[model samples]
Target: MDTCALFHRYWALASESGYGDDLSGQIRRSHGRRPQHGSTANVYHGTFIPNGLEVAIKTFPSTLSGMGDGSEVLAGLKCIFREVHIWSKLRHENIVPMLGMSKDFECTISVISAWMPMGNAYDYVQNTNNDPRPLLRDIASGLGYLHGHELGPVVHGDLKGLNVLVSSDRRALLTDFGLASMNTSTFNMTVEAIRGGSYQWMAPELLDNCVATTESDVWAFGMTALELFTRAVPFPDCHSVANVVGSLILGRLPPRPTQESTQFRLTSTWWEICTSCWRRDPSRRPTVDEIAERVGRAMYDTAPASFTASSHAYAPTMDTMQSRLSFTGDGPRSAPITDNDNLLPCATLSGLADKILSLSFSPDGTQIASGSANGLICHWDVHRRAQVGPLSRGHQHWVRSVAFSPNGQWIASASYDGTVRTWDVHNGVQIGSSLQGHQGKVFSVAISPTGGGIASGSADKTIGLWDVQAGKQVCALVGHTDKVQSVSASQSRIFVSGSHDKTVRLWDARAREPVGRPFEGHTGMVWSVVFSPDGRQVVSSSQDGCLCVWDVRNSSRVRHRLEGHTDEVTSVAFSPCGRRLVSGSMDSNVFVWDAQSGARVGASLRGNAGWVRCVAFSPDDGRQIISGTEGGSICIWNERIH
Candidate 1:
């Protein structure tokens, strides 16, 4: 059908069907003065005469008259023509429905659709407390529908958060088809062009001067996820375009958001899917159907309590929940081990000359290792509550953190001397010359679950993966801008790091690079990060006075931020079952929290007269909790339940 003929037929059909009067008559009655409305391409919100069904009218500017050859103007007209052509055929609930288009060259080339009152998804995240999973699902569904259409696969050249429009019913609709194209092959547009593309969301291949592909669309969807969760542009910290492209080439990603303003935070599964989309190899990117499935699973896993509410109904106020905020205590206080039922003081290792800085129970629970401020790493017999062997004393500076290898044969310790050393726990002898690389204080060390290597994070703003047997620095994972305070290795490939940069970052120790984006929610230095037993989640404590439990497999977002400590949280450890989290603080108390809900389980466990520097759950069965204090005391309390 011809363009003018099709337009006239569409208008006639609308008028006859009571969808307001014909386009020309409506324009005439309104005196050609359509109200300026929300726009993407000169689209104006207007009333349709008597019935007044709200509509958005997208018009092509007539300024093509003054330009020399009018090629620039010609391109815009072509874009409008393409939008109407492509949009008029799409009939999915998640896709914006086109009402009609006008081809009157005298006025302007225009296309019209239903006006979306809620505006873009990016804006919606900022103003609403509504859960965003449904919106993301809708976008993925719409994109999948377009790609799986019987005619041909359609490529949305641009699919950032801004391109997604939110309807009055809160349904997200994929709009702006200016750069879209139907293709039979994989990559559609082969022209080496950066024009009309969102650089921040563009795939690395596209940035490297390739064409738009279905895979590239998937990449943009991942970037859009970052925007929806973070409420900011991709790579918000990277100020220049050059830096963004450079980061992508070097395999860096946007930081995960830590905000609790939303009804549901992004899950670890969601983040895993998102990062997979941004993989450097475009061929490895997931299809739209796969994306939809992943998003569906994430929604099912992390659905909020308010998921069934109406669109207009906002999430309930969290003030009551906020009462459990960390730091709501009455000054500095202490509680005894016997305060709660079944609780007893199992053991106390006293008479140490210097304060204990770190504590770790061996895998078999037969021994406990304590790193002291006196540059000594002592192994104590857990059964007898006595020091067992000579101290592994080679570090010239205070030992900040310590961990026992999975096999319980070696102890890895981080020290202020800027070195990470592994020692034979059996003989209390230093394993080898200090594993040196960091130029500043080594604050934390974690032995891999395989016990083959140790990972250390230091004040030098780097994480070093060292081979324990070989005693050599393998690679330095450099990303954090501030001191790397704590490092925790998962059972397999991943490791998590918390830093003074106020972020928790995921890394692939095997690959020696960041896995996904850094978790960027803490307002103060993140002092500790620990993975759950299954390596599916991460728990981190910060000077910000919040303990954040993050889903590590899906999204790196802070799933729960437990509050109650008024002082800096020094250490956090997950129970063996991963159901509970124990945190020690400078407030001189140890608190336990429900990992899933971020709620306090009971009153704080207290005994230390000074700040609690470290904490560990007994590896045997979590029936006991051990804490190292600044006052040179190690307290072990038997767990009891009523």
Candidate 2:
């Protein structure tokens, strides 16, 4: 369909679905907006609507698919849904996220993501002949983490040029893992159950053994590693590699002519790693950690490698360059607001030996409160862009967490000392009290919307409720079998807690009993959780890097899984309007996303020198953003970029 026709149908269907009435029109201005993208999911980039973001949007089904194609639709949705689930499990620097989804027959799944201005690695290979080493390293690191890290063994069953994204700086990242399988679950999946992967990069065993094993994956990675350097896929030239399936089973070895040069010397170490990985015997393959150890050691021993991705992957041969926010960096930096033209003054808060940790806006917007583990809570006057109050102190340890009460009169700080301390918001004086019932370090804190109490989550696997006014411990809500990483107030009706135990619990503050049932579906520790605007939608973040938005009213995670943020999402806060969300993480950046649209609003918020410990919105002011960093600095980001 043409743009007009698609918009017409979109509006028509949206009206019929009643979502037209609910359209956050915050995105109304983004109507008819489209993403500037390279080839991947075949669809019109222009026909989609912005989900309150600039980089990605949902495409209107002009016609890459069909209606009677119900099976295709169902299968595609399943694949997409599976992609959502799997990607959530693998978060790293080179991997983007795909979180909770929203879909309509007229539109494909929501494209929740930040911008990648340089396009994909394929673009680099097509445009430049420079070496793709940095990206290769990043890809290797990501794949390594997947194949061998803390929660890895994640097999990107389908690794190809198209799935590798290239940043403007030529940094490469892996994308489109719809067919990727977790290493831990590979044994549970049969080849017959899902013969998913790119034919060109398929390991010989995938055809012979017909099972996911270390060797098969290593073989695929070896080929992928080669493909990265050569930019050559097995198709068109190999006549669809599927034709060689039988030969693979017959144990016929393929030739790999080494290109020897000090520059391109496919030496013994290289071959040892590659050949071992591709060895017919899975036992011979080196894990990602092993590869990292050797490669990292080699790099350390040798001269520093240049950003080869720039030389080979990001050559300035692009015929087109398009971006909404004109970036100032020669390379694409994460924070979109960092544009030199839009640069905000640095007078907000400075003179610290650390990064900013948590940022919160006072209800009146007169003060912006920032808390950092530097053992100080700094308050900045909005108009003056200067410190307004004495540095709030007391938590000797890094203030691991902080929250502002709904009334804006109190600020709660969860510390490394395993105590929750209250500070007078205006005076910056300690409340002269602390909640000391927990034996483990406090990890998170939340203020009840009703303004009567506070909820503190600890590493001890318990959540303690306190009467803010009474300044006394109200009750201990316990059930998580492991460390409680996060807690959120979903109105006074329900309180949600997520834990390392791999379960999310919902409790009624009034009834003193569990609500409905535990919302389950994560395979790793749940790290961040928050309530959606209406109080019915609850969003939880996990080590899997997936954010499952749940329907609190019905006690079910919204079918959509929010993915991205290549690290544990340590903190999450709803936008003042609740249509947007901001998440902080160990990755040292913050991501602001449109709740309904799933589009990252700006570049990932940066300038944090260390792990971003917490993120919070100003109670009434939407533009004021406050973030606390591990380095003990608080940054106040006013929505206005220079």
Candidate 3:
């Protein structure tokens, strides 16, 4: 496809995947102004206005390496696809996260990421103080993660001030690795290499065609450190690129920063790190890894490297890394920044535990299990509000139901693809699959109180007993004339199914036959059925606006006509206290009813704009109701109502 078509195709895919709004907003706040005009790659800030996320979008100009403007047409569509392959292999924390790449590299490739709201070190220095020593330590730690992590030694060729992104927590992230190469003139050491960096802060070796070894990077780091502290160009008052070049060739290095009296003292320890960085010999400077260890030993008791080990795997090896630096590889002089302390701070978003689809907390109120659309299930971390997964998969489709075993260790999920899977909630591993021979979707599933196996109701008009581990049909109880919409299992070995049969029937899960009677009450298809927490009562909701609470042992309806739903009630659950019943309906309301009196309690929550897909109470804070909507939003309501 052509570039224009390719761009539209990518936009369509991005919208479908939900990756752009989540990841691209991260890159925008971290980027500074473009280093040079007409550079192949231009960096811009992207703020997610509505989602409250920020990201960076890096665009590669049409003509790469200036191979003659006429050669632009030679770059084919496959060439853009090739760039995607290159970026897809790259993953790191100190490095920027790659969200989704557009189809064409020449268009705009955006990556969403976490924001560093504290602002870049360059801005922090000029705005807060000329000597940003605390900031320098953070910068070292980040580079240490990148270069030392065994993920492959990533040499960020463009390591000047403009590209060193800062995190709000004051940590530094070395970005823009797309410019790096395998240390050759063609790879990175050519004049065209000046495409995306601040020349004033570039090490001389970067301009003079020397390999951008770790040592050369150290020299650039030193110049960046100087700029970070002083808010001044490495060479002050040069006025223009011509004047700076004249001074450099005529034997002038940017004036060394003189020690000054300030709140943050620039002691000999600081001078040692910075001056050694500018050593004329490439072999004379420290690798980013070495610097992080020494500085960390001085500040935090143990190397913070241990903490950031999660960020990059190379942390263990920074202890013995070695590098040779070069100072004379030089390049064209560049103009300095006109705005020193300006910072348009980046935005931040809390990381999600997973790509959540459908979530549910267990009925017991002690544990919560969330079933993901990816065919896995996760239990929530009560303290962190994040998901902790022992995730297991057994279903052929997304999990639709997750009911905790009476003891709370096992959970079952009904699947659209006709299977009921049980899981060991503590380890996130599948314990068993109940593969009943159903001709259609398993619309509802429930576990027996004895914890032996499960009963699954399906569109095939049959509800069956599934041997929990062997994953086979043990018994088939068939009576419904249409799809079995819902099922409820009780401690008395009784399973009740509500269906388009317009009735709720009692089946003995182990006896291979229907129990004493089938209670006919609804005028339309049944939608949901729940065993009352007491096990003696069962509440069933249907397409007809009636909810029936039946006295299980007697096979009689104690309340045949619980009312008030304008539409089918899709979900029903009893509160842990067992005295209150909660039900969610397609009418976009959640109602709580007094279980004994059959009276509605709390007023319906009407804020949901779409059908309430899920309603859950916090295991720790039961009064707080959390609802998930069809529009892809989760809202927590802390209000307590009676």
Candidate 4:
């Protein structure tokens, strides 16, 4: 309602530099500072002497001006309306003010706003000796006003420390509405608009569905509070954006800064508000008004005298803050240093034919089950390092994936023959009739945490949830537009899938429906996806020659992208403790990466003689890494950090 009125008032002066009547000398970029990238535009520093206004100019790149003349450039036009019309009407001390806009004949749109010389809140906290209590209060006030504005409840789709600018007076003003969506209950942006920036501050629902609400804003506010206190990004414990999303989806909260770092002594009252704002159920999260009240009380309880409402007669100088500040840029923190050495082959089992598609260790750590290219399923005794029995008969085509049931009593296998089969572990005998329904190759299979359902992802671009006991399809999940490559069932009812579509998706076992928006980031086909032992994160291998760790709770963001393999990453698995990750690739190497930091734990394991098709961690601990090569030789490497 509020946005429409602003759009109507400025319709006559659309795309004109004099629309706001604040136009001054031609703004020129002279010694511009580092730019802050958004989904649509980049904000750069510029000065316009016409009004003596030191401002930041957000310029929309012409590339997004869709091909064709005038009207065809809908994206560019919408961005203009958002900044010049909607944002310009918003007037509040806590909200960044839009001064003017200019659109050239070349289709470049630029929106100018008064710049805050003190920098962003993140930098202020990092570089200044100033207390963050006032900044936090200012941020809360700004967010509250935006959510309850007289015009409309504008959902600031992207809220983080960088978007919260610090004025010369040490006040936080909410800025950057490039991702803002107005008058909509659910905000959905295109996939191209999803890149750039860490998603640590996004709410779970917003990450999963691209749907941002006022409640979601409250969630992000909580994250910003954590950032203020920690002087680090929210979910700093996570190694990647993918991991952060997984953690949120699984209801995992970021660790308290006080517990993890010695930077600040975070009080209990502040922590309480932070956790309350992160409640998984959006309905349970505190409203922005309620949050503002609580933050005010926290500030009062902590320091009452530091916060006083008034405008100084002269513009404040950046004396104390900028003098101590120094930074190149911001990104996901690096992994802690750990052991880095190539794993040596301790043993090798050689007997099978061509490529080994899948492998898994028994739950008890005594045995391993592997599916081969020729549809042969074999079992091995770990201690003896030998096959327990002869290869068993199964699917007519290649067996693409294999998994041991939670109880370790059965093994599930998916094959190119378009069927799923279960086999008893103790005896090489089929458990029941073939589970059929898929119209294309069944590439991956996973046993549910409850051991009740067996999930399979197939070339049909559908997911099948089958009842393990009945051996029948329960329901079909149709979401991925390309072939489904991998499936992993979390300890809970949630299951995740990777696809040739270059996306990962989450599904609820009980609801038989998709959970949230697809986790879209990979540029190549996703070959494998598996959940961590705790179900807080997911690891996926892709044809793009990298391993991606995604946060299961926050389904839309990729937390980490581990690159090193020379070719496609074929398989990925988590250690028993969920602290380490092992991946095999077409490069004939097996690599281990730290689950927390997304850092490669050690050098690539290099004893294999051919392309490494599959890898599995020993169920006992991560002491041993087992990998099966294209030539059907299973190499066992010791994973001790040396």
lDDT of 1: 0.72
Off by over 4 Å in 2: 1-352, 597-602, 608-611, 630-642
State model 2's lDDT: 0.59
Candidate 3 lDDT by residue in tens digits, 556-580: 5556467987766666666555676
Report the CA-based lDDT of candidate 3 relative to the real structure.
0.56
Instruction: Score candidate 4 by lDDT.
Output: 0.71
Q: How many backbone clashes does candidate 4 have?
A: 19
- lDDT by residue (tens digit), candidate 4, 1-642: 233233334433464533354343467654736887766677788877653346787776753344454433554455555445557657776898888865431235677888786688888777423446667777887888778877678777778888888864345899887666556322222223422234798777766555677888888888888887778888776898779879878878887665334233357888999999999889999998888777655542321111121233311111000001111233111122112211111111221133567888888889888887657887876665545654567689778888999889889999988999999887779888999999988999999877889999998889999998887999899999878989988889999999978899889989888987889889888988989999889889988888888887786678998988877888899998998888988676777777899887545665423567788888887677788765445666654432
Q: Could you tell me every candidate's TM-score relative to the true structure?
A: 0.46, 0.45, 0.43, 0.46
Q: lDDT of each prediction vs. the true structure?
A: 0.72, 0.59, 0.56, 0.71
Q: How far is 115's C-alpha from truth in model 2 (Å)?
A: 36
Q: Write the per-residue lDDT of candidate 2 for residues 1-642, one digit (tens) a residue.
A: 243344344434433533212222222223454544433353222211432232333333422255445444444444444555566565565786443233443445444444454566755654222344445555677777667746556777777666777753244778766567664442311232346566666776566437555456557766665565555654334464555665556655445544532235234555566566666676777776676555433321122112111232212111111111122334122222222121121111222223344566666767766655346766666554445556677777556667777777878888767888888877789886877788877877878787777788887778888887787887888787777877888765678888877788888887766787788888767877878767867777776766777777776555557777765676778876788787777666677776876766656565423456667776665665666554333444556433
Candidate 3 off by > 4 Å: 1-360, 372-376, 390-394, 432-436, 553-560, 607-609, 614-628, 632-642
Error of 1 at 187 (Å): 72
Instruction: Say which prediction, candidate 2 or candidate 4, comes out ahead on TM-score.
Output: 4
Runs of candidate 1 exceeding 4 Å displacement: 1-352, 554-556
Best by the lDDT measure: 1
